[model samples]
Target: MAGFFKRIRAGLNTTIGFYLLVVVLFWLKTYLTYRTDFTLGVSGGMQQFLLLVNPIPSALLLFGIALYFRGKLAYWLMLIIDFLQSTWIFANILYYREFSDFLSLGIIKGTGNVQNNLGKSFLEILRPGDFIVYLDIVILILLLLFKVIKIDKRPFKFRYAFSITILSFLLMFAEYSAANANRSGLLTRTFDNNYIVKYLGLNEYAAFNVYQTQKESSTRSKAKAADLKSVQSFIKKNQVSPNVSYFGKEKGKNVFIIHLESFQQFLIDYKVDGKEVTPNINKFYHNQHTIAFDNFYHQVAQGKTSDAEMMLENSLYGLPQGSAMVSYGSSNTFQAAPSLLHQAGGYTSAAFHGDVPTFWNRNNTYKSWGYDYFFSDSYYKNKPNYNVGYGMKDKIFFDQTIPYLQQLPQPFYAKMITLTNHYPYELDKANTDFPATQTGDSTVDPYVQTAHYLDQAFGEFQQYLEKSGLAKNSVVVLYGDHYGISNNHRPAIAKLLGKKSVNKYDLAQFQKVPFMINGSNLDGHIDHIYGGEIDVLPTLLHLLGIKNDNTIQFGHDLLSSENRQIVPFRNGDFVSSQFVKSGNTIYDSSTGKELDLDNRQKKLLDEQQRFVNDSLSNSDKVVYGDLLRFHKLKGYQNVNKKDYDYTKKHALKQLQQSDRKHQTSLVDQNGGKSTVPDFKTNAPELK
Candidate 1:
């Protein structure tokens, strides 16, 4: 053992061995950071294997460059490489903590804005253990000081260095080919960044992000106004008229949109151990004052919840690649719900989310969308006990926002986003009264409990609204933003669902999310009309007695008898009442059997596919070209970017000032007090 140790030390002291050592150390640190810090979707053994092998080529390519030089110059170059690489990993760690997203070159361009927005709170993003990433440099410096590693006496050889560099590149190409074989077009196609990082590595994703950003930028520059004509024409031709019975039911009523994170339709009446998972929502769905859609699907793409938000607000499809909020938000021209309602119906608009203003760039995007105020994380008590994975726990979020909601002017459009039932679903154990599932997967057990907790919170909030008299004149809207459990967890979820087998079609069906609207004037019925997030804007606009004609909305009123039932997903897949098309496979919606489409069916599918393409392309052009600036809609007023200030302090102050000036706010009418005490909840966190 002593002899082996001596030989190892002797080799490590040599120049070549030092280079290998530094490269290995760097890869090890990055791998550890990936496994520990970021949720890069390492769910199974295959993903873990990929994560292990992914860092090899990048580490070699980076550290190998230092090998071409000898002595102090090479040593310094290796150190610089180490510093830069570590810095990249550290930045990603901080970014993932806040956004649950990977960094992109386009987003990083706003570094100054991000830093300025975060202020001192940015320091909170750093964990104490993050300092461990620098320990390798400390060890190396100590070794050099102790004369354990000395500069090599040999002169540099370019031929040897060049061959090693070539060998590294060849190995990378071979590995990439193997990965693509496992998942076809793995390298070429743009996918969710999680898949990229899971299959490749962070370093590879950075390089790929740069390539994608440049490609997209080039496409944007080449986009022409002529691109707008086709999209506008298609929207105009396909637009549906509003149903007379539902056209103006909720006109002049306050709008309260509740965005439920990760709450799926499957949980509507689902039970485990004889206890309902979402009892409150189930009751609300069947209420006489509520209208609910059973087959409603969230049409979010890579942006997930943010994409759903964009689609709901703008009646436009989210970008196929990345989040429109993070990618095109600052630059895009939106004809959104807030702006449209304000201009057309004399409504005031505000949004409440218990998260940092910049999570999805809502701080900036809301301004462009013409929201009058935004209440973000600063307005909430986001302590660890009150806050969970994404943001504030549901009970606290709802309980605290009553004051702010009361201060909004009459006929206000307000949105409140809840966050307890987010992905990797976990809740404080004391908070849940529900029993666990018999399924062996521990990961699936907590989902029901958390969802139940969210339901209870909602019930409490609903009672408060009714008691406070706000429910009399408010249209309360509820919807799930996107899927909670990913396909990777489908097997376990299937077992819990009592399915013999679950396939992609089953998964797609499981993508159904709850969509409901409750109001005193609404004649509650189970509307079988199929719709997605994009259809929400026009549907709600029609309810407010605002016509969507002459507007650039791509969706139709769901209440319309002529509402289009075809729903196109972002990935070129689509679902209709009769068929579910995924990639090249077509399935009968009733039987779930694969179908060989006849000529007529084929033509219809092809046309639907083309419409999907044209719609997406046109939406992208509207965003990229800022075409809304070119055409003025009949009643729409151009959103003065200065109409809103997004700071929580400023927003609250504005609400206070409005309350004083008008003295007509609900809180002022109730003698200048908060109604939070009216809310009741069984949330264990509050205990």
Candidate 2:
């Protein structure tokens, strides 16, 4: 035993031995972090083993770079590289804690994605054990300086270094092959970070992200005008004709888009103990002034809220991988609603959210969309009591927006992003007294409380609009961004839905979210329209009497005679008026039973599937190929992102300067006086 220990100690004193030591430590540290810090959804013995071993290839490939150096410099180089890796890991740890997901390459290069509230959020996420990520580095540095682990003053042979590099390549190939065998086409299939990190380590994820970024960049770089013709042809072929009954009904009306975060359509009139959960939203949803879609769904992928926003504003699908807003919003050209409405009609576009401007890269994304003003958390009277887990409390957010909302010009397009009902559904007791569900689910129980609070806030907002007279001239649209309850809490969801079990059909139904358009002049109808978020832009354009001729949009207006209403989920799963396709099986939409495939039924299903597939593929092409950059709308200029700024000083100054002569704002129209005093709310947070 003593002889073996002595031999190991002697080997450790060599430069090659030091590199091996560093690699081992790096691999171990990464594995430990993966188990402790991240929720990669490792399952089965195979997945567990894969997760355990994924770090080695990256560690070997990276640490082996120091092998080329001679003497003590090699040891120092390894340690320095170790320090950088540690820093990167620690940064991800902080980010992952808050977002429950890994950071993307775009975030580092974002205008505010990395910098916005980074200090406060990062410090809050930092735990005592987080220091351990770098503790090994500190120890290794000290050991090297103190000469406890001596570095051999020998030069590495060229063959030895080359062998190490080649070995890393071999290991990487094996890991990738294993992952592919486990999940076919693991690299190209999905963009969900958990799947990526579960199969491959963080280093490989970063490499993949860089590759995706470069691929997108190169595709855009090599894009030609001819590349867009096919995309345009596809869009034109699928073009939906506007319905004569509802076309241009809400013309010249102020458009208010209220984003109900984490809300599902089942909650529309859902009751607990004979009491409505979202009383206010339920009221607006069913009222005679609203055009409600009972079958509307949100089509979001890994991008979530940002994806919803992209589909709503630009009528384009988000990238199958990472957020298009984060990846392409800064540089990609867009014919978004904000810019389109502004240029087509004399309307100002604004987005009001209580969160930081950088959360979904909305700071830059909004600029690209040509929003004239962005009323973020900074624009609100932010108090300690007013804040919630995600951002400002819903009631306070609505209450604070009175002044900003009043200042916006008439016929303006404003999107209000509510945040109180966000994930982890933690709401302070003071915010609402709504009873928690009896599901005993940590996630599902408290969801009602936050959702109820959002409802109350929405009610107050509607009342205020009526009192302030904004309701008379404005058309308000409400939508749920994405699914609040994920598939992980199946037991709780089944209990909540009063089902014995939650199957794929039930999960498909869970994707439904509320979509309503309320306006005083419009006839109310609860239309059973099977449309998704992608259709929002075209619908709104038609409502506003704006013609969308010679433009490329993947979605059709819901109130259109020609709309076939085939809503495709991000995962290629689709729900139509007739059938719901989940994985390999198809279910009847009306019966929720698996289709007994007759020859005719099979043929019809196959045709619909092809249409859904083609629509998604063409939309993706528009984004990846930057086809919009080549396809220009007649007399409409693409948005200049630099012209818009989200800062408080700049937004206010521009609003005042530009609207000085026009006197077009609601406040200007309300006798050149503030109408905020008329708005009333009983929010406890305000008190």
Candidate 3:
């Protein structure tokens, strides 16, 4: 035992042994970070093994290059390389702590609002335990200081460096293969960043993110005007006339769009433990003033919530990969809902979200979309215990925004985004009166509780609107942004949903999201119309009595008699009342059985395919080619994003200016007294 200790100490004093020590330390740091810090789905032995091995190649590759250099230069290079890699890992850890998402080049460029708002309090995300990540560096510096392992004097042989590089590359290849086998298409699929970091390492995920951003940038630049022709003709031919009965019924009324985050249609009247999951939303859905769609789905791609916003606001499809709002929003020209309503109805348009303005690049996107005002985290007083994952709790968010919402002029178009029900649904125990499901999956259990909380918040907001006299003359549109739980949680969800089994078809059906519109003048009807987020803007436009005859909208009016109910998903899937075409498999909508389509059915499927393809193609063309810049709608002026700013100071100045410019502001009308009450919630965090 004494001899073994002496040998180990002697070996560790060498340069090669020190390099190996660095690699091992990196691996340990990653494991500790993955296991304790972030929820990277490191469950079974297989996943644990993947996490353990994935960090090997990156550490080796980064440090191995230092072997080629000599003396102090070599030692310094190794330290620098290790530090750079560590920085990347540390950045991801911080970002993932807040977003439950990995950092990317595009996100980095777009998160100015986050940096500016949170920079002063950045220590909030760190913990004393996280200092372990730097312990290895400290040890190395101490060793050099104490002369335990002096810098190597010999020049590193070419063969040694070459061999190390080759070994690192091979290990990396093996890691990719293993991850791909376990999580099919780990390299190619439109997947969540968490999955990538779980199976493949943070370093690899960063590399992939850079590559994807560059590829998207390349595609955007290469887009041509000629590409717009097919999509334009297809859209023109598929236009549906608006329903005369519902047409202009709520014309010039206030539009209040409530964006429900991570909400699904399944929770409308769903009962868990014999208690309603979303009672308030259910009641509102069934109210005589509400028109709810039973078969509506969210067709968001990799962008998730942001994609839904892009489609709902612009009547355009999100990109095939990554967030369109983040990737192309600043550069693209959009004739979106805010601009359209402002131009057509003399309406003041504003969007209220209790999140970082730079989230999804919304600050830039909203400006480009011609929003008169945007109330984001900068405008919100995110007091202690007020905010949670993503942003402020839904109740607090709604309560705080009422003053701003009221300040908008009559016949206004405003969107309020809720945030409590976001993914990996977490709520303080004190707030949760509802019992969790015994699904053994933590994500599946809280899904209902947070949704219930959201429902209560909505009910409170609705009551406030009624009390303020805004409900009578307003069209309140409630929509689910995207699916809360992903396909990874499908099996557990299937058991909770009381299904014997679930497949791709069942997973596709899980994408259904709630869409309800309530107004005093509009008649209530349960419409079984099949549509997606892309159809929202045009449908609202018709209700507001706007003529979209010359506008290039890809979606048809859901209220129209000739409404094209064929909804296209971003991932080459289409769903309607008749059938669901997902990838290569077709399924009967009414029955869950597989379809053996006859000649007529096949021909219809082909036509639907063309329509879906052409629609997506055209929408992409509009975004990629900046087509809207060339074709200005009559009466609509070009939006100058540079003219608008959503900084805290600027936002306040604009609000005050609006108060002065238009005495119609509710704050002025109420003699500077706020109509909103302090927010109250059952959340344990508040207690």
Best by lDDT: 2
How does each model score on TM-score?
Answer: 0.77, 0.82, 0.75
Tens-digit lDDT track of model 2 for 1-687: 999998988888998888888888888899999998886767778789889999898788788888888987788789888999988899988777655567766556652562344565466557899989888888788877887788798999889998988998898888888888887768875335677788888988889888987787788778788988777777778887888777788899999999999899999889888889998898898899899998888888767788999999988887665688888788878899988998988898889988788778788888988998888878888778788767888888888888888887777999999988887676776776888899987667888889998998898898888888889999999999998887656798899999999877888898799999998878888998799999998998998888886778788889997889799877667899899887657899989998889999889888887787777777877788777888768989988777777788988898888678677887888888898887677777676
lDDT of 3 by residue, 585-606 (tens): 7998888789999999899889
For candidate 2, the clash count comes to 0
Model 1 score (lDDT): 0.79
* Whole-model lDDT values for every prediction: 0.79, 0.83, 0.80
User: What lDDT tens digits, residue by residue, belong to model 1 across residues 62-143?
Assistant: 8889888888888778888998888888887776754556767755664444332343334644678888888898898788
List residue ranges in candidate 1 displaced over 4 A. Answer: 1-67, 70-206, 215-227, 381-384, 646-653, 656-664, 667-678, 682-687
Scored against the true structure, residue 19 in model 1 reaches a CA lDDT of: 83
User: Model 1: what TM-score?
Assistant: 0.77
Q: On a 0 to 100 scale, what is the lDDT of residue 60 in model 3?
A: 90
